[model samples]
Each structure stands twice: as C-alpha cells, then as structure tokens.
Target chain A: MAPLIEVADLRTHFFTDEGVVKAVDGVAFTIPAGKTVCVVGESGSGKSITGRSILNMVPYPGRVLDGAIRWQPDGAPPVDLLALDPKGREIRAIRGKDIALISQEPMAALSPVHTIGNQMIETIRLHLGLTKADARARAAEMLAKVGIPRPKDRLDSYAFELSGGMRQRVCIALAVACGPKLLIADEPTTALDVTTQANILDLFRELRDALGVSILFITHDLGVVAEIADEVVVMYLGQVVEQGRVDDIFHRPLHPYTRALLGSVPRLTRHRPERLPTISGMVPSPFERPSGCLFHPRCDRFEQGLCDRSAPELDRYANDRVARCFKAGAGS
Target chain B: MLTYILRRILFMVPVTLAISLVAFIIIQLPPGDFITALTAQMAENNETLDPETLAALRDRYGFDQPMIVQYWKWITGIVFRGDFGQSFEWSRPVADLIWDRLGLTLIVSFATLVFVWVLAFPIGIYSAVRQYSWGDYIATFFGFIGLAVPNFLLALVLMYLSSRYLGASVGGLFSAEYVNADWSWGRVVDLLNHLWVPVIVLGTGGTAALIRIMRANLLDELKKPYVELARARGLSETRLLLKYPVRVALNPFISTLGWILPTLVSGAVVTAIVLSLPTSGPLLLNALFAQDMYLAGGFILLLSILTLIGTLVSDLLLAWLDPRIRYE
Candidate 1:
C-alpha cells in the first residue's frame, strides 16, 4: 500500500539578513499507517521543520520551495496537502480532525487566560459539535485519559495552576480528543525529566496501539528513539542521512554520521575506554555546502577524491535499511 | 466568584480613599487665600470685609483649618452623608454641579469609546493582517498624522466645517435659536447637532491612541506561540486574532485605567472649548483662573475621583477578564 502521508522532494529555505539558510533542503520521507516513526537530529537539523511543514505552518520569511505532501485517506485519492488553499474550510476540517499537532513547549502552547477545560471543550465542541454539557463530560474523560487527576475539578483550573507535566498531558489530550489519524509530536518530552519522558513515551505507544493512530515523532534524543520508535530517520543539515527499521538503525548503522551519533551515546556496558567518537567538524552552512555529500566535512570514512567531489544517493544495506554514503557497499 | 468579587470591592475602598487623599493634596496646592477671592468680590458690593468676617468666610470654605482637619471633614461628609460641600466660583453646591455636567461628559466619553473601538479595532486588525499593504500604509499614515496634529487644531477645523456644511451655528451645546427653548426632542437633536463636532475632534486623538496601541498589541500577539497553536488547532484566523490574542494584548492598556479615564479630562478641555459645552473642565479652567479656590478645588476633587474610579474599574475588569491577575 502507498504510504499514509508521503512528502517527496521537500525544500524549505529562509531569506535572512546574513544569507539564505536552506533549513529543509530536498528531504523525502513517508509515514505509514499506525506506525511510530522517530526523526532524530540536533537542534538545527530541520527535524521540527519537517513536522511543521506537514501542517503548512512554516512561519514567515521561511518559504517552502517545492514539494507535494500527498495524503491518501483510507479509500480516497491521494490529496496534495501543499496545493490546498490555506483558508478553505476543508483544510481547516482536516487539520485538527485528521491531523493533530502537539507543539514543543507545552507552557507556551496553551493559553494562560483560558482554563484547561475551556480550551479542551472548545476544541471538542468545534470539531465534534457536542453540546456544552456533553463537551464538558467528554473533556473530563479526555483529561483523565491523559492521566490528569480529578479531571472534573481540574476543568476550572487555569494553565498556571497545573504542573508542567499536567499541562503537557492536557495539550496531548486536546490534540487527540477527536481521534486524529496522524499525531505529530515535536519533541514532546524535551522539557520533561527522564522518568517523566519514559512514562510519556509509554503513553504515546499506548495511544498508537489502542487508538490506531500514526505518530511522527521529532526529537534530538537517540534514547527516545530506542524506546518508542518502530522506524528511525537520522537527519543532518536538512537532509536525511540514513533511515531504516529501529533494529537496523541501532544495531547496523552504516553512515559515518550515524555511526558517530550512536557512538556518542553513553553506554552502560564497558566498551573499549576511548575518547567518545565525536564528529570532528560542524555541519556546513547551507550557503557554503561542500561540493559532494553534505556530511563530507565531518565524515571520518571519507576517501580522498570520491568523497569530496561526488554526492551520494541512498543505497540498500543489511536489511531493507538504506544509508546515503559513498562506501555503503564496503562493510565496516 | 461572589466572594472574590465582594473581597475585591471591600479592598477597593482603601484604594479609592488613598487616591482621593492624593487628589485633595493636588487641589489644595498653591491656591492661597481661597476664600479671600470670593469675600473680596462680595466686598465690592459694599460689604465691609473685616478680619473676623474674612475668617468666617475662610471657615465656611473649610480653608481656615489644617489639612488634616479639612480632609477629615470632607472624607467624613463624603463617606457618611455624600456631600461635597459647595463651589465658591459658581455658588452651586458641588454635588449639583457634578450632577449637571457629569452626564454630558460621561455620554461624550462613552460615545467616543464606542466610536474608537468600532473604527479603530477593525482598522488596526486589518492593518496588522495586511501589513505594508496600502491599507496598512494608509492607516499608519493617518495614525502618525493623528499623533502629530494638535487636538485643538482638529477641534477648530471641525467647528468651522460643521457649521459651514450643515447651515448650523457652531457654538455651545445647542444652536442659538434653541438655547432657551424647552427641552424637546427637537432641541435634543439640535444639541447633538452642535455636540457632534466637538465629540469627533475630542475623540480623535483617543481613537488614534487606541488604534496605535491595538495595532502594536495585535502585531505582538500575532507573533506569540499560543496564537500559532490556535491557528494550528484549526481555529479560523479571525477567531484566533479576536478570541486569543486581543484579550492578551489589552492587558497593559486596560490595567492603567486612571490614565485612560483622565484622558477624557484632557479631551474634555478641547471638547468644551470647541463646542462651548458647559462641562466641568471648562468651568474648572475658569475657576482656576479666577482663583475661585472652592470651585476649582471642587472640580479638582471631582476629576480626581473620576481618575480614581477609573483605576478601580480597570482593576476590577482586569480581574474579571483575566483569571491570572489577582489583587490580594
């Protein structure tokens, strides 16, 4: 079957004072139905940009260069999300109902003036056409579903009265109340502690299994990917360097960039006591990208003329996994 | 909510009292021999003004005593019996003076507010949303001009043009033909006819101020993440702007109620002069110049009370609109 949501050849760039920052340059990926796909990258690697672009919410001064994000709902023709007029009610209906988004900062995401229950019920009422009474009861149920204690009483409490975790859960519940087929979580646990992050990840897994919702998870933490992701995509400088099932990605990484990233993670088992295999150089600025592969500046597996002058395409590795590197054919 | 509101009202008493006390101090400053001016005028009508007689006038005006004693008397009378004593300039009881002019100013102010919000909000929102478009540029051009040009000049032009256009004489609250005519519907319409020019001119700067404030606030709110989240949640752009952002943006403007209310007095200065309305601002100006201390002080106290009440009302509104703000 075709992917549930497929973004092919997406390019997003920003025109700024200093130079054009090609924030998301020619990235391609697909999210399948009922699967949790985690995108792992550092701060500026354009992982979050991919998530935002799905909703057509790239902020001003940053324009999507070109792409067709096609969506094939259960029995329908694949609709081009990028081509839809932003103001049409059809797009609005599809947004929170079919695709829900939980943003990065939960504190900043929720309106402080509105009580948790007010915002939640407002959304339920808008999407479901529930009566105020029905919406309230439904909101309370959703709140409890997100593990908020005393859901009925909590409805009267403002955003400030709730803790950070509770507020984040409230955000999640609001996003999921309509049973969106696709839930895009952009680093949902960044502000949370380790234990809370684990619990939250577990909650996401439960959400995917029980409700049959597909998740597009974006984060910088490889640890989170290890716990929850069924498939993983590693990105650098706005390009996906490697992608595969979760097992192949962690156990049999082939790309040098991916290898450096996995090696940098702290391991409990005693490995050869060597300095952490840090990537030697920074990702090149978009304006000054190397002639060849985007990762050539920091690729330790680089060979003299081949790595510097020629770009590489994705090559099949051990499983159906793929790595975008010149020497993927050579076993490490 | 009832308890919270009751507690707020109870707390407001001291706040209002404190403001009134400050008002009292401001009014009492630098206007020496308040009673002498009136008593001297009386002396011109062949009344012999001896020292004892002068002291009696002073006592009657409540100026022969210490500040504490005068304050105590005014506060006691105000709290217990709702009396504001008398105006030395107009020879009218202060309460009666307040009663007569208060409605006109309040109506003018309320009308001005409605006028501004009705015009400025849409204009401001349109400007921000279509930023740098001709509508934005045009709105901005007018906003700047509104800030630069003096209110009095606008008042003058309005008076001149209004009379010329409508074949109406541009003087006081009513046309000369109806000045002493019975208070009929016809006369009321005539009153509004003359009143419109001053109201428009007086409210011009305030409306402009509201426009600029709303524009800046909306711009700021539009950039906020919550607004972004609302849009992402499939809220229509209009709903996001009005429901989420405007409420957040109005906090700073609404919080300082005293300043905004007292702006009416400033507007009233131009309004009374332009329309020849018999409002307290013009009366206060005349009394101050005539050194009619009792009359000036009475108006000052009234203006100050309005300022204080404006602040109190804003505080109450802030609490109501934003559950986040608390007085206690």
Candidate 2:
C-alpha cells in the first residue's frame, strides 16, 4: 500500500536563550495508508514534536528547520506540507479537514467555557461548510460513534463536566469528526487510567477500521504499541533508532537501545525476578548531548572507540526494517 | 438561577443593615454632632447662639436623645416612609441631595467604565498575542505610566493643557454659560465635549490595571492545552484566540463589577474636586466633614447596596458565561 504521509530527515529545532536545541534531529518515518504507526520513546525523545511538525503546529520559538513532509492523500499528487507557508490557507485547509490531532491531556484539551456541542459544531461547520443544524447533527453522530452515551445531551456538557475517560472519547470524536485521512494522536491515552486507556485504544482501533483512516500514535507504553501498532518506530534522544513491523521489533529487536527498552518491560513469568531490568543512566539533557552515537554512553554493548568516534547511519535491513546501530543484525 | 438570585438578594438585607449601622456610628464618631459644627462655624464668624435657641435646635433634630434612640428613629423612618432624614448643611432631605447628583454621578461612572473596557480589551489582547513585540513594550510602558500617575494630577495636567493651548474653559461638566441653563441641544453638546476629560482621567488608572490583568490572564489561557487544540481544529488564529483565551480572560472584567459600582459613586473624589464636576463624590465628602450624619450615612448605605447589587449581577453573569460556575 502507498504511504499516506512520508516524513524524511525532519529536523525541528528550538531556539532558546541558552542555546539552540535540535528537538527532532534527522528523524524519518512513514505511515502507510489505513495503518497504525506507533512512535514509542521515553520522554524528551521528540516523538510529540515529530507529530506536531507533521501539521506545522510546532509552538513558538521552534521551527521546522529542514524537512519534507510529503502528504499523498487519496493517491493525489504529493503535496509537501513543510514547503507551504505555516500560516497560509493551503496548510490550514489540510489541517483538521485532511489531518487532525488528538492531544494527550484530555482534561485540558477542550475549552471549559464552551459546550462540547458548540466546539464540535464549529469545527464541523468550519471545514465542512455545513449549516448549524447539519453540523449539530454531524457532531451528535460523531459523539455517538465514539460510544458516548446520551450523545445529544453529552454535546451540551463542558470539559470539566465529563470524566477523564469521557473527555478522551470526546477528543477522539472531535479528531475523527472531519473524517481526516490521517489522525495524529500524541499520547492520547497516557493520562487515563488502565481501563480507560484500554477502552480508548479499543476506540482508536474501531475508528480506524470504521473510518479507514491511518493513525500515527505516539506513546511510551509498550503494551499499547503491542495492542494497536502495525508498525513501530522507536526513538531515542530525538532520532529514530529503530523501526519495523511490530512483531519483528518485539520478537527480534535490532538496535541495542530497542533491546534495552524491550528488556525493561515487566513480564508475568513463573520465576519472577526481584526487580525489572532498567536502561542505565538518564536521557541526557538536550543541551549537552553526548558525542557520536547519541545512546553510546549508556549502551551496555558500547564499543571502546568505534561507537564513541563516529555516529552510525541508519542500516537498512530485510522486510522493510531500519536500525541506526553499528551492530544492528549481529548476534547479541 | 432565579432562586439563587432571589436568595442572594434576600441575604443583602442584614448586610445592608450592618453597613448602615457601622456607617452611622462612624459618622457620629467625630467629637460633636451637626449642631456643634454649626456653632463652631458661627463662632468663626464672630456670631453667638443663645442657650435657648441652641437647646431648641438640638431638641428638634433629636440630638438631645440617646444615640440608640436616634438610630432607631433614623432606621424606622427610612424603612417605613422612604425618608432619609434632613441634611443639616443643605436644609433639604438627604434623599433629595443624593437623587439630584446621582444621575450625573452614574452617567460619569458608567461612561468611564465603558471607556476603560473599550480601551483595555483590545490593548490587552494585542499585548498578550504579540508578547515581546515592540507594540507590547510600548503598551506596557504606557500602562505603567497610567497606573503610576495619580488621577487628580492627570486631571490637573489635562486641565492646564486645555486651558492654555486650546483656550477652552476647563472645569465643570458644562461651560459657564450653560452651568444653570435648562437642558438644551447646545448644552448637551457642550457637556459631551467636557465629559470626556473626566471620563479619561478617572478611567486611566482602571484602564491600565485592567489591561495588565487582561494581558496576564490571556497569556495564561493562551498556554492552556485547549488553545492548541482549538488551533488544531483548523480555526483561524484570530477566531481561536477570541473564542477560547479571550472568553476566559473576561472573568476578571466580570468579577470586577462588584467593586466598580461603589467606585463609581466615590472613587474619583479628588479628581472630581480638581475638575470641579458636580458629582456626588464632593457632596458626600462635605457631608462627612460637616458631621451631617444622615446625609453621610445615606451615601454609605447607597454604596453598600450598590456593591451588593453589583456582586449579584457579576455572579449572574459569571454563571451565564461558565457552566462549571452555574452547576457548582
């Protein structure tokens, strides 16, 4: 299948008073049409920034310094999203109508002063050019699609009036309301409880199937990746260290950082260890990034001179897989 | 909502009574009553009041009675007959004096409120949205200057500049010719010409303070996740800003209504005196100085009632604006 969006060598940087911080440096990924691509990383790994850069919604002081986000919606001629003006009408027409976002903070994602119905109706009307009555009907239909009970009444509810779970559902409903081809969910289920998180993941799967929309899901939860991702992109320190089929990435992970991440997940074996394995050392502060391979300082398999002397390019492998490690496919 | 408002209104009765009692006591706290103040004035003029006339005046005004008995008479007369007692200085009913000035006072106050709001809202939004731009810096500088300079001093400066440069007669709500003239189109036009000076003078401090408040509030709201979410909805930047952050920023403007009413009546006292405007502020000041308890107490009670009403109106408006407040 053709990829819905192809992000190549995307470099987003934040210019701060202290110095310049390359937030998402040389990151590359692709989301296939009608497929879920989960971007997994620890905090500060630039997963969220990569997601935001796709929509040209990076916050102030941050710019997409060099990148090409080729969006080929419905097999139309490819449009380079990064090439368009960030504030121009072309990019705006693509946003929400062709690509929408679901934010992590459900509690703070919706305006407290506006009703759910008011917010939903406005978005529907803005992009779809529907009348108020038609927008209301569409909003109500979208709310019901996300399994919100009493969808008509729920439309009148405020963000603060709903539970955390219900709010996430509303956000999901909002994201998919315009029937965008690609949905970028930035840690959409991170703030929820375990059950609600599971329910939201299930909702994402159901909506992806029902609407035939692709999803770029950013998360730190391996379990969510396993449950929902068709492909997985593992990031470390603003770079995509490894990405492949979820089954291959989980069963036979290539990059040392990917192995370390997989090892850190707790298991339910008969002989339980005293403690779960952990990746040693902290994710270095953005300002003082280590030389050579970004993860070399903490890699247990770090070569004495080679790993510290020069950064390794992403090594392509069979089955459309890629890993940025010197010893990617060598025996562990 | 109706029940809530009614409950709040019912709750104001005791509040007003307590305020009236405190105001009446504070008015009486001075060394002597109105009769004593009159006697002192007479003595200053080298005139004397005989004991017989003095006793008769004191008896007639109920000054000879106990303080509690005097308070009872005052409260009963106000509640039962809507009379606010006689002003010792003006020899007129206290209600009449307040009513005569109340109209102009309200007009000035409401005009100033409108002026402050109209100026503050856009300037505040611009400063917040542009943030560190040169426009923001310029606005911040002017805001600080407005807040720092005293209103009366501003009034005086403007008065001086107008009289000197424009050769305009620069005091009162009308020109000298129209001071006691009947209402006419020309007089009304003249009043409008003079009204803006006092409105701007009184509104400066309020406008400056509200601008800072609005900017800070909008800046905070602009950072909320909801604002980003709104922008992601493909909403235009201007629409997203006004719909989300600006709506939330208006809370301070609404909540300020509680104090804005009382300030309307008495806030610009020095400024009014400096400009020679016929507002209630100076009248209330003189009433207190003359130890005219009824008139002074009446003004204080009116202020308290206005404050309560203002609070009620703001609360209702807030409830209308925010669902959380309404349900809560």
Candidate 3:
C-alpha cells in the first residue's frame, strides 16, 4: 500500500524583487499512520516551506513549482493531490478533517476577536457536522485532553485572556478537535517557555496515544527532534542531506552537515573547555547555491577541487540510512 | 465605550463655542454693515440715504451697538432663547429658513447614502473573492466610469435620457401634480420616480469609492494569519473571509468618516444644481453672489455641524462594533 502521505521532489519558490527565492528545493519525505517524522533545519532551510506546500498555502509570488503530494485516505481512493483541481479536490476538506496544522506563533495564529469556544465550534461544525451543543461538548473534551484546565470556563474566554501556554494548548485542541489522522505542527511549541514547552511536548505524546494520529513535526531545535521524533529528515538549502531512524541518525550519524548540526546543539551533558564547535558561515541563497554539494563551502572537510564543484545525489548505505555528502563516513 | 462617548460629547461643547466665535468675528469683518445692504435698494431708487432711518434699523437689528456687544446679544439670544436673527435675503428668520431647507437636504443625503452602501457592499465582496476574474473586471470597469464621470455631468446625462426617452421633466422633491395631490400610492410612486435620478447620479461615485475601499480592505484582511487558521480549519471561503475578518476590514473604511461632511456638502451642491431641487446648495450660491452674509453664514454653520456629527457617529459605531479596541 502507498504510504499515508507521500511528498516527492517538492520545490517551492518566491519571486521577489531581488530574484526568485528557492524557498524549498527538492524536498521529499513520507509519514505512515501511527508514526512520527520530524524535519530538522536551521532558519531559511525550507522546513516551514515544505510543511506549507503540503496544504498549498504558500501565498502569491511563492508557489509550489514541482512536487507530488499523494494522500491514501485510510479507506478512500488514492488521490494525486497535485493533479486535483483546487476546488475539485476540496483540499480544504482533508486539512482540518484529516490533516491539522499548528503554526509557530500562538498569539498571531489565534484570532483575537473570537472566544476559544467560538473558534473550536466553527471548526468542529464544519468538519463533523456536529450540532452546536455536541460540538461544544467535544471541544471542551479536546481542550482537556490537551491539558488545558477548566476547559468549560475557559471556553468562554477570548484568546487575549489566555496565557501563551494556554493559547498553545488551545491551538493544539483546535488542530486535533476533529481527530485528524495527521497533525502538522510547525514549531508549535517554539514560543512557549521551557516549562510550557515540556508540558506541550508531553501532551503531544499523550494525544498521539489517545487518537493514534501521525505527526509531521517541523522545527530547528535538534533537542526537540530527539525528544519526540521516531524518524528524522535533515534538510539544508532545500535538499535533504541525511535521513534515518532517530537512534541510528543520532548515535551513528553518517553525514558531515548532520555531524556539524549535532555538534552545535548544546547537550545537557556539557563540560566545554574553550570553544563550542559551531557551523561556520551562512546558508547560501537560492541564486548563489554552491556548484556542488550545497554544503561544500561550509563543510569542514573542504577539498578544493573535488568537494567544491561536484553535486552528489543521495547515496544509501548500511542500516537503511541515506546521506548526500561524498565524505559521509570518512574524514577528509 | 459609553464613557468615552460621553466624554467626546462633552468635548464638543468647547469646540462648538470656538466655531461660533469665529463665525461671529468673520461675519463682522465685512466693509458695509447689514443695514447698509438693507437700505441699498432705497439708495438705488434715488432717495436720500436717511441717517435717522438707518440708525433706527441698526438699533432694531442690534447692529447699532459695538461689535463685541452685538456678538454677545446674538450668541445669548440663540443659545438661551433659540432665536437666530432674521435672514435679510429670505425675509425669514435664519433658524426658520434652516429648518425648512434642512429636512429636504437630509432626505436626499440619507437616500443617497442608503443607495450607495447597498450597491457597494455586495460588489466589493464579489470583486475581492474573484479578484482578477471577469466579474471583478466588469465591476471595476463600471466603477472607474462612475468615479471619473463627475456627478454634475452624470446628472445632465440622466436628465436628458429621462426627458428624451421617457418623457419625464427635471424637477424638485415632488412633481407639480403631486404637490396638490394627497399622499396616495400613485403620487408617492411618481414622487419616487422623480427623486431617483438625482440619487443615482450623486450615489454612483460614492458607491464606486466605497467599493474600492472594501476591496482593498478585504484583500488585506484575507492575508492575515487568523484568516489562514480559519482556512486550515476547513471553514468555507464564505465563512472564512466574511465571518473572521469582516469587522477588521471595515474599520478603516468606517473610520474614514473624518471627511464625509465635506463629501456630503459637495454632493448636495452638485445634486441641488443638476437636479434643480431646492436644496441649500443653490440658495447658498445665490446668497454668496448677492453678498447675503446672513444666509450664507447660517448655511455654512449648518454644514459645519453636520460634518462634526458625521465623524462622531462613525467613531461611535467603530468603537461599538470592534471588540479588540480599548479606550485606554
């Protein structure tokens, strides 16, 4: 059977005044039901772009150029979503009903004028056709499941009255209210403080267990990937450089950029003497993408002629791991 | 919001007082006095300019006193006794003349407003939803024509069309036959038909302007993140765009009340002359030409107050409708 959601060779670009920004270039990933996958990248690495492309929410001047996102509904026909006319596919029907998204900023993400109850009721009614009373009851239940206290009273409160942590919980409740099969959380907990972040992450685990929903999480923090992701896809300059089972990728990483990423992450078990190993230089822009192996200029093992000018495709190695760098396992 | 409104109402008192003082001062600055204009006809008839008769006329009008004393008498008489001195041009009290013309102007102004809003809202929402489509292009194309064709020119075209094709006559609030007839359905119908042309000519430009504002606001509102959330939640286009952001989008257009009185004044002027209706526009123009300061000043004062009230009404409405706003 086809994977529940399959995205292949996706490229999205924004036509800005300076030039066309290759926001997402050649990104590919998949997630099966009852599983979790996380896309890890630095700022401008196209993780968010990849997530937005799945829903075709990328705005004007930035459009999905080349990609196919196929969804095999649990019991429905396999839909080649890219080929489906926007109105014909009713892509929106699948969004809140089957695939929900939580954005980065909770405050901006939540509509200020609406009460939590109002927003939740609107979504539930649209997707489930639940009566107002039934939808309200279910909304409260979902809110409690997301660890919001006093869900009944809090329902009547406007978004402004809620704390950042509570707003995040409300957003999570809104996303999962209809019991969607997949949740696309794009840095959903990034705005919360440490304590709230931990609680929200734990809530995610609990909710996942209760609903059997898959989550395609996107974030820049490696620690978050380690905490919740079952599998990890590392992206750089719109291309996937490494991907594998979480444990394999963490313990026996085979790619240079992945190593640099892991090195830069400040682990709790730290006794730094002089310098924290950092990834030097900036990510290249779309127009100035390196001639070969996009990370070649920034790679520590820079071989002048061999590494700088030759692009390498993804090469699979032992243990079902794939790395794009030519010097994955060998030191330069 | 109620407290804020009350405070604004209280603040208007001092502002109005200052306006009244300025009006009195400017009206006093003219070279010849009111009695001089009053007796000009007698002088034109080659009679002696009688000093004693002029003094008695000035004393009766309270113009014989010093400027500040006369101003004090006028202000007090109006504020305390509800008396605006007689109009030299119309041979009626200033207040009575305003009372008669005020109702006619208001009815026309209000009818025009209703017509414009009703026409603009749906067209604007349509254009925003299918922004570059044929429907939008058609609406915007007609909108450009409406905006570019001055109200006066449109009024002329409408009058010509009605008279030439429909055998109608350009006229006032009601037809000559309807003036003597009782308020029956047929007379009311004829009156409405006569009123329709002026309303359309004046309202078309207003509707076009409002449509542009609504389209821009709706487009901006649709780009907001909350709108995205609404879309992601499977809310239909109708619900998402209209329900979630309608109020946010309307605030700017509604808040644009700062200049509506001037717009109304301009509209009334054009409609009054083009429609040949007896609104204050023609009256004021005639007054200015004949140097009738009493009628002109009173008309200007009434227009100024209407402008202030229009802005106040808009602010009150915005405050009530948008919950996100706070007085503090």
Candidate 4:
C-alpha cells in the first residue's frame, strides 16, 4: 500500500531582518499507515517546524518555501497540501479530520477558559456532523477511552481544574476524538514527569493499535524513541541524517550523528562515570550553517578534506536504511 | 459563588464607611468651613455682613457643631432619609440638585464608554493578530495620537470642525429648546444628536489606552501553545482568536471597570468645561471651587459608591468568565 503521507524536499524558512532562517531545509520523509515514526532531534533541529508545516500552520515571519506534502487518505485521492491555500477551506478540511496534533506542554496546549468537553465536542461536531448531544456523548466516551476516570463528571471541568497528567490525557482524547488517520505528537511527554510520561507513551501505543492511526512523533530523547517508535528518523541541523527500522538503527547505527546521539543517552545498565558523554559543539545557527557536511565540525570520525569539501547525499546501506555520511557503518 | 458574592457585599459596609470618613476628613482639611470662605468673599466684594445674620447663618447650617458631630449628621441623613444634606451654593437638598443633572451625565458617560469598547475591541484584535502588518501599524500610530492628545484639545478641535462645517452646535447635551425640558422622544433625539461630540472627546483617550492593552494582552496570548494547539485541531482562525486569546485579553479590561467609572464622571471635568456640556463634571468642579461642601461632598460620595458597585460587578463577571477564580 502507498504510504499515508509523502513529504518530499520540504523547506520551511523564516525571513527575518538579519537573514533567512532555514528552519526545515530540504527534508523528506514518509509516514506509513498504523506505524509510529519518531523524529528525534535536539532543539532547533526543525522537528517541531516540520510537524507544523504538515498542518500548514507555520506562524508569521515564516513560510513554507518549497515542499510537496502528498497525503493519501485511505479511500480518497491523493491531495497536495502545498498546492492548497494555507488559510482556505480545502486545507482546513484535511487538518483536523484527517490529521490531529498533541504538543509538549499540556498546561499550555489546552485553553484554560474552556471546558475539556467543550473543546473536544467542538472538533467532533465540526468534522463528524453530529448533534451537540451526540458530540457530548462521543467526547465523554473519548475521555473514558483515554483512561480518564469519571469522564461524565470531568466533562464540565475546565482545563485549569485538571492536573498536568490529566490535561495531557484530555489533549489526547481531543486529538483522537475525531478518529484522525494521522496524529502528530510533538514532544508530547517532554513536559510530563517520568511516571506520567510512561503512561502517555503507553496510551499512544494503545491509540495506534485500537484506532489504526499513524503517528509522527517528534522528540529529542532517544530513550523515548526506543520506547515508542517502530521506525526512527534522526535529524541534525534541519536535515534528515539517518532513517531506518528502530532495531536496525539502534543495533547497527550508520550515520555518525546518529551514533553520537545514541552514545549521549544515559544508560542505566552501564558503569557509573563522573561526566556523561555529550555530542561536542552546538547545533550551528541556521544562518551560519557550515558548508558540506553540517556535522563535520563536530564529528569524531570526520575525514579532514572530503567531509569538509562536499556534502554527501543520503546513501542507502545494508537493508532498508539510509545515512547522509559517505562512511556509513565504517566506524562500527 | 453565592457565598463569594455575599462575602463581597458584607465587606462593602466597612469599605463604604471608610471611604465616607476619608472623604469627610479631606473636605474639612482645606481650611475653615464654607462660612469663613463666604464671609471672606463678601468682605472682598465690600459687602457688610451683620453679626446677627452671620450667627444665624451658622446656626441654620449647623456650622457651630463639632467636626465629628457634623460628619455623623451627614452620614445619618443619607442613611435614614436618603438626603445628601443641603447644597450651600444652590440652597437646596444636595440629592435634589444632583439628581437634576445626574441622568444626563450618566447617559453621556455611559454612551462614551460603550463607544470606546465598541471601537477598541475589533481594532485591538486585528492589530494583535496581524502584528507588524500595515493595518496594525496604522492602528498603532493612530492609537498613540489618541493617547497623546488631551481630550479637551480634541474637544476644542471637534467643536471648531462641527461649527465650521457641519453647522451643528457640538456643545452641551441638548439643544437650547431642550435644556431642562421634560423627557420626550424629540428631546432624546436632540440629546443624541448633541451627544457624539462629548462621547468622542471623552472616549478617545480610553479607547486608545484600551486598544494598546488589548493588543499587548492578545499578543501574549497568541504566542501561547494553546493557540497553536487549537489551530492544529482545525479551528477556524476567527473562532480560535475570539474564543481563546481575546477572552483572556478581556480580563484587564473588565478589571478596569472600577477605575473607568470615576474617570467617566471626573476625568471629563476639563472636557466638560471646554465643551460647555451640562454634566456633573463642571458642576462638581464649580462646587469644589466655591467650597459648596454638601454639593461637592455629595458628588464625591455618589462617585465613590459608583466605583464600589463597578468593582463588585467586575468581580462577579470575572468569576463567571474564569473558572480558576470561581471558587476562590
């Protein structure tokens, strides 16, 4: 079957006074149906911008410069989202019904003044063409489905009345209330405590299984990627540096950036050290990005002349994996 | 919620007393009583005041009573008989004098307030939503002009323009024929025809200030993650803005209700004087200048009470709109 969505050469940029910020430059990926594809990156790696671009909700001062996001819904013809007007009805129709999103901060992601049930029911009624009463019933059922206790009573409660965990659960319930085919969770568990984070991850897994929803999960934590992702896409400096099955990437990593990212993860099974390993140097500012390989300045295995002289395209290696480095898998 | 309202009402008693006490003390602080000022004025005019007449004047108004006793009399008179004492200048009950013009002042002030909100709300939303765009910049520039120019100056300019071009008298709350006339549809229509000048003059400054505040508040709210969350959920842009950020931005505006009432009555003093409008503003000012204690003090008391009521109304509204404050 064709992938649920195909994003090709996506380049989202912000035109500021100083210079253009290449927030997401020449990015490409696909999310297959019913699978969780986690995009792992540090801050400014453009993961969040990429997710926002899919919904055509890039804020002011920024615009999607070039890209083709071909969305192939289960029974409908493929739609080119970039071709549609960002503020027009055709794109709007695809945003909430076909795709939904949950963000990092639950406290900041729910409108404080509105009741949880009102927000949920609004989305359901908007897309599903249901009566207010039916929408309320569906919202309560959605809340219960997401493990919110006493969903009927909780319906009247405002977002401010709930705890952080409960708010995130409400956000999840809201996202899945419309039965979207795709859900983009942009670091949904980052603001959560450890226990709540686990529960939320478990909830995502349950959602994918029960609703057959494809998830484009964005996070900077490799541990979370390991816990929830079926496929992993590692990004560095606005470009996809590596992509493969989760086990393939974790067990036999290819890209040096991916290897370094894995090395930086704090392991519970390993012996203790005074200082944990960290990826050397900072992610360069978008305006001051280095020539050739963006990671060459910080790569431990950098080839002095070749890596700095020319950029290497993503090369397929072994079975069904791609890495941007010329020396893929050589270090291992 | 009922208990909260009840608690607020109970608290108003001591607050009202405190305000009244302070007002009385301030009124008495300047110098000797109105009798002294009157005698001085009479002497300046080379009029001889007979001692017997002076003593009788003092006796009639109870000026011979102690300060505490005088304050007690004033408070009790209001509490028991709804009388605000006698206006020393007009020689009538303060209540009767104030009621004569209070209705017109209220209509003018209320109309101005409604105009301010009606103009500010939409422009504020647009300016914030389209920050840095040409439309936003134009509104911002004009808003600053409104704030910087005094209302009296604006009133003068408006008066000049209206008389110069429109051939309409832009002064007072009514035409000459309707001055002190009984209420009628024709009178009301005349009042409205003459109303816009004062309303525009008085409301401009507040409208400018409120627009800036609304824009800033909504800007802050727009940057919040919830706005993005709502947008990502496919909410139409217009609905998202009005339902979320604008609602939050309206808090400060509602809280300003108490401050706005006194301003509605008092802040227009200079504007009223300039426009020659028959509002409480000029009356209060003239009374204060003449040391007409009952008239001045009554206006102050009435205004203070209005402020308290405005605060109570805003508090109730806040509790209704924001769930976080409902129980507390």
**Is model 4 an incorrect, acceptable, medium or high docking prediction?**
medium
Instruction: Name the 10 consecutive residues with the lowest summed lDDT in model 3 chain A.
Output: A80-89
Please identify which of the two predictions, 2 or 4, would achieve the higher lDDT against the true structure: 2
Ranking by lDDT: 2, 4, 3, 1
Error of model 2, residue B47, in angstroms? 3.5
Root-mean-square deviation per candidate: 3.4, 1.5, 3.7, 1.4
TM-score of each: 0.90, 0.97, 0.87, 0.98
Name the candidate that leads on lDDT.
2
**Which 10 consecutive residues of model 4 chain B have the lowest summed lDDT?**
B319-328
Flag regions of model 2 displaced more than 4 Å: A270-273
**Candidate 4 per-residue lDDT over residues A1-332, each given as its tens digit:** 88899889999999999999988988898899999999998899999999989988898789999988999988468888888888788887777788998988999898888888888888899889899999999999999999999999999998888889999999999999988999999999999999999999999999999999999999998889999999998988889999999999999999988888888888788787646788899888778999889999999888988999899898887777888998888958
Query: What is candidate 3's lDDT per residue for A1-332, written digit by digit as tens?
Result: 45678888898999987898888888877787777889998898889888878876776768888988878868467676666554333887887889898988898887767778999998899889999999999999998888888999988888888889889999999999998988999998899998998988998888888889989999988888889998899999888889888998888888889988998887657886747879999887678888878998888887888887788888888876788887888842
On lDDT, who's better, 1 or 2? 2
Residue-level error in angstroms, candidate 1, position B319: 2.4
* C-alpha lDDT of all candidate models, in order: 0.79, 0.92, 0.81, 0.89
Query: Measured by C-alpha RMSD in angstroms, how accurate is candidate 2?
Result: 1.5
User: DockQ (Cα-based) per candidate?
Assistant: 0.57, 0.76, 0.49, 0.80
Better of 1 and 4 by TM-score: 4
Worst 10 residues of 2 chain A by lDDT: A266-275
Query: lDDT, candidate 3, residue B2?
Result: 76
